[model samples]
Target: METFITYVSQNGFYIWEEFYRHFLMAAYGVLFASIISIPVGILIARYGKLSSWVLTFGSIIQTIPVLGFMAITMVAMGLGTTTVITTVFFYSLLPIIQNTYVGIKGVDSTVTSAAYASGMTRLQLLTKVELPLAVSVIMAGIRTALVVGIGIVAIGTFVGAGGLGAIIVRGTNATDGTAIILAGAIPTALMAIVADLVMGKIERKLNPVNKTATA
Candidate 1:
């Protein structure tokens, strides 16, 4: 604990900069992924035939090793934050996509039928009803993706992308740098835990079931 405090005290500025960078990369990745994945998820839910193909592709992307995935992305974009962000975006897709699909699909059929019976168009049903009800589930997916993104971008240090991982890696190269490693790792873990809790709270708030009960 003493060594850890000493390193953090000495390198406070550097750690802060990297920690900030690390968070931004994760936030950006999750933001970009949510933008696209939510729509794709809705599309798949409407067209069940496409769900298998779309989800399968996402699964394939998720299965790729981060290093290998980054390597391939680097071929087109080269080493940098952009490459890391793109990699983060891709890595984040599966959970959000899968969750979106499941959320929309999981919506009560009777509720949807009532909406359609009231003369709602497909788009109206989706935007006004389905999406609203699925917001909680979709938020859960985004929460999961952001947490996952935090972990993925940690590998960003190797790709010349600065993040907390850089500090952790520095500790690894030292004769006894456990303190340094913990300095970086503790923040990363904390970020994930904090994100999950905050997002989970938001998720519960948005849940229709919760709203109904509260009412």
Candidate 2:
């Protein structure tokens, strides 16, 4: 306990730096994943053939072990932050895509029909009605992707992308268990909590019906 406390006291700045570095990389990964997944997901929900192809391709990517993916990426990209970021981005796409498909599909058909009857065009109905109603479910997928990306970004330390994992790796090498716990465990838990809270806020804001019920 004393050693852990001392380490924290001495390395506070390093810890914060590591946390932010990983957090940024994870955020980038989520952004990239969403860029590809959101549109693909919408298409999949709207079209059966496209959905099958997307699911099959995304599944293949998911089935590959993280380490294997990293190794292949490093080989092609020659290792560094970019390799790690790319790996994380690919890993995050599956959940977002799947959730988006499910969320849009889950919208009530009657509501969609009414929107059409009210003279809303296809694009208007999708953008104004379906997308807003599906925000909660879509955000659920984003939350999953964000958390998963954060966790995977830690592994990027092996390829020289600095993060909390640096401390864990260094501590492991030097036989310092405290380093591993402080570096790996705490940041991950904190990231998960913060990400969940942020996403929850967004979900609430998007869910005006729930807001009205409460009011």
RMSD values for the candidates in order, in angstroms, are 1.1, 1.6
Please provide, for model 1 over 14-115, each residue's C-alpha lDDT reduced to its tens digit, 9 standing for 90 to 100: 999998999999999999999999999999998999999999999999888998999888889988899999999998998999999999999999999999
lDDT of 1 at 204: 98
Q: Hey, what RMSD does candidate 2 come out at?
A: 1.6
Clashes of each: 0, 0
Model 2 lDDT tens row, 1-215: 78777788888898888888888998998899999999999999999788888988888999998878988999989767898889989998889999899989989999999999999998999999899888888888888888888888888888888788887887777766775576566877799789988987887776757856888
**Which pairs clash (backbone N, Cα, C closer than 3 Å) in model 2?**
none
In model 2, state the lDDT of residue 3.
Answer: 78
The local distance difference test score of each candidate is 0.94, 0.86
Among the numbered candidates, top TM-score falls to: 1
The residue ranges of model 2 lying beyond 4 angstroms of the native Cα positions read none
The segments of candidate 1 whose C-alpha lies over 4 angstroms from its true place after superposition are none
How close is every model to the real structure, measured as TM-score? 0.96, 0.93
